[model samples]
Target chain A: MSFLFARDGHLLELGIDGLLAEELSAAERAELDQHLSTCAACQARVDEARALMAQPLPALASHTAETEEIKPPDLEQEWSAANNNRLWVATGVLLAVAAALLVVVLPSGSQPEAFTARGGELSLEVYRQTAGASQLLLDGDGAAPGDTLGFRVRLSEELHFALVGADSNDAVYAIWPPQGGSAAMGPMQAPEQLAAAIQLDATPGIERILAVACDAPFQLSDEQVLSISEAGDAPQVQEGCAQELVRLDKARP
Target chain B: MPPTLDIDQLYRRYGPLVLRRIRGFFRDPAEAEDVLQEVFVRVMESSDSFRGAARPSTWLYSVTTRHCLNRLRDAKRRRELLDEHGTAMGWGASAESAQQPAQLLIKQVWRELDPELLEMAVYYEVDGMSHGQIAELTGVSRRTVGNRLAQLAERAKDIGGGAR
Candidate 1:
């Protein structure tokens, strides 16, 4: 297709007025081509006009200071734990503040005796999946260096666990509970099933862990430490407040 | 006193350019002024740490770009909640840049761009920085910044395409 010469005075006029539709009459097209050959000044004007026309259409101006900045919730408030099952209300806002400071900030020489050390409160929950053995749900209030945590899943009645090491991606540090022990690793095969507290261990730099079995009800008490082991691996241990009672219902397929 | 790097003086020197740039983003002059004022306050607060980094104007551009992006995100969130299409109207028909007319026109046109593209253009065209410097400051790939500038040029051409 022949192009309209932007330098053609007649064409420039038509262009500026938004009259250059997809098709042009033969006479109008002829006029534009002929005008371009003789008019260098018109060519420059067309260029200038084209530049100006490319400017962005004006937009409504936005002001910055007037916009509200959204801040994260106060560092000191406990997040009520509620998920696939029962709701567990931990300490309130005051304790949340203690936890936040304990977890975040560098320790100072003048730190309060109450704030001398940081700790993680561990809990385990079991979830039921229609097509899977178990899903581990982990949450934490605070984490510090030298703190270690793990989720132990028993895949068989023989108590085989596929485990994962903290901070190292793609490493399955699996373990198996000692042979002929009181508890056996079992396949998770039902919805609303319970996940045993296979293991909870705290080493440095580990956060919190919550393991949900495929189907079952579970309980949290202050009295127990759960052991989780994988094949040919030493048993990993966890201690903190015990498992809170929880229930899992299958999500619609 | 180490030659005082008075933010106020810097403001006096560069405020008009920043205002005109910001004015390109919003259709309302009042809002543009508000963004300008916020920029000044932020410069003042952070000036102590500048320690003679890149040219002051380049640093200012980086700061303004981030500030504008954050504001844009916030605007998007508010619009989402209210279920309205967010708009940034343009302004500044009367204010003239202190630069010479041709330069002023270029600078004014610079405002009519998305802040991200405008930032790339200013860094490349005005500040004379290599794409690497821009990538480092903006935390984006150099190739991405280059692509943005190319797109910006095409859009600018289309708008001005019919002008001449």
Candidate 2:
């Protein structure tokens, strides 16, 4: 009962290695302690393995730009759609230029530079889990690997805010409007927290996540939409709309 | 300028881990990178559903795993498309992401694993969960966790050798 032996009646080296990695906890750690107390061989194994592990792991190769920047087929479709829309706009521009005088229409009080039209405000914050409750991240900071991070969005108007994230590897993701549904809801009266949280793992990279709030639901074609209700699905990004949301950054440990 | 998505910070935090996880799951690291971008796009698409109720890792874990699996399912189509188009015109995948015959052989081996075993392997190997953690997540015993990982490794090796 005291010795941490393999089924073969010898010390389990894997268990010892796991113990050295601090992988064992609770009952396993207690059992490991008992085994270490009496087993000199196991102790030596742990010491040797621990020393070897202390040496730095091999440095990873820097990924190529193409590898980092490439995206899956669906996003390419999304990007192509956005590109097609740009072509249409270009055609419109040609027709407009053909006209002698063009009157631009602007709604009253609508700022030319703002993301929102109807006096809407948008902001994004990252919440990190520490001790017990979640703490807000500041200064475009990041979280440690394995830490739980959640995004909270504050919107002045009840609008749809699409959330998107890009990783250090240059992969762009729709962190909010996963695939099928419309944009996420913003608070009507005040700034509020999002319900889902992100768990940072040992991926050893940073993430930038943002919420783009719009006055109306951002449009995505059915063909463009990936089924978010299913796992591993992505929604198409309407490039123009996605570019218009609020943004934030998280540093990873 | 698009004010919504923060370009610089977005790449900083989630980039490495997402890329790493995607790479771990797929045969080719380049394809993993491509999937990595799609995963982020999916995150945006599901903005409405994600309200910070669950841990973001949990959601991302399944998303990454499932997305890789689904893409693998379409590997045949991808191969045919690649052959027809000769790696041009927005096929989205780079030349490096193209599926090799050996990779396809491995994928066949991967498909033969029990669904539960495959899921557990992904959680442990890619998500970096321990046997105990995987057991808790999957409602299985620690011994079963150990066994499944060994099976996954052995099968992978077996297929890798067979492909050559």
* CAPRI-style quality class for the chain A–B interface of candidate 2: incorrect
Which TM-score values does chain B get in all models?
A: 0.52, 0.46
Summarize candidate 2's per-residue lDDT along B2-112 as a digit string, tens digits. Answer: 234442343343444445445544435455555666555445434433344133343444555554543433324334434544422121111122234324433445446
True lDDT of residue B160, candidate 2: 65
- Give the range of the ten consecutive residues with the poorest summed lDDT in model 1 chain A: A108-117
Give Cα distance to truth, residue B115, candidate 1, Å. 11
Please give the RMSD of candidate 1 to the true structure: 22.2
Steric overlap count per candidate: 63, 56
- For candidate 1, the per-residue lDDT at B88 reads 18
Q: lDDT score, residue B139, model 2? A: 53
What docking grade applies to model 1?
incorrect
Model 1, A219: alpha-carbon shift in Å?
Answer: 24
DockQ score of the complex predicted as candidate 1: 0.03
Score each candidate by Cα lDDT.
Answer: 0.32, 0.41
lDDT by residue (A136-155, candidate 2, tens digit) is 34322334544455444456
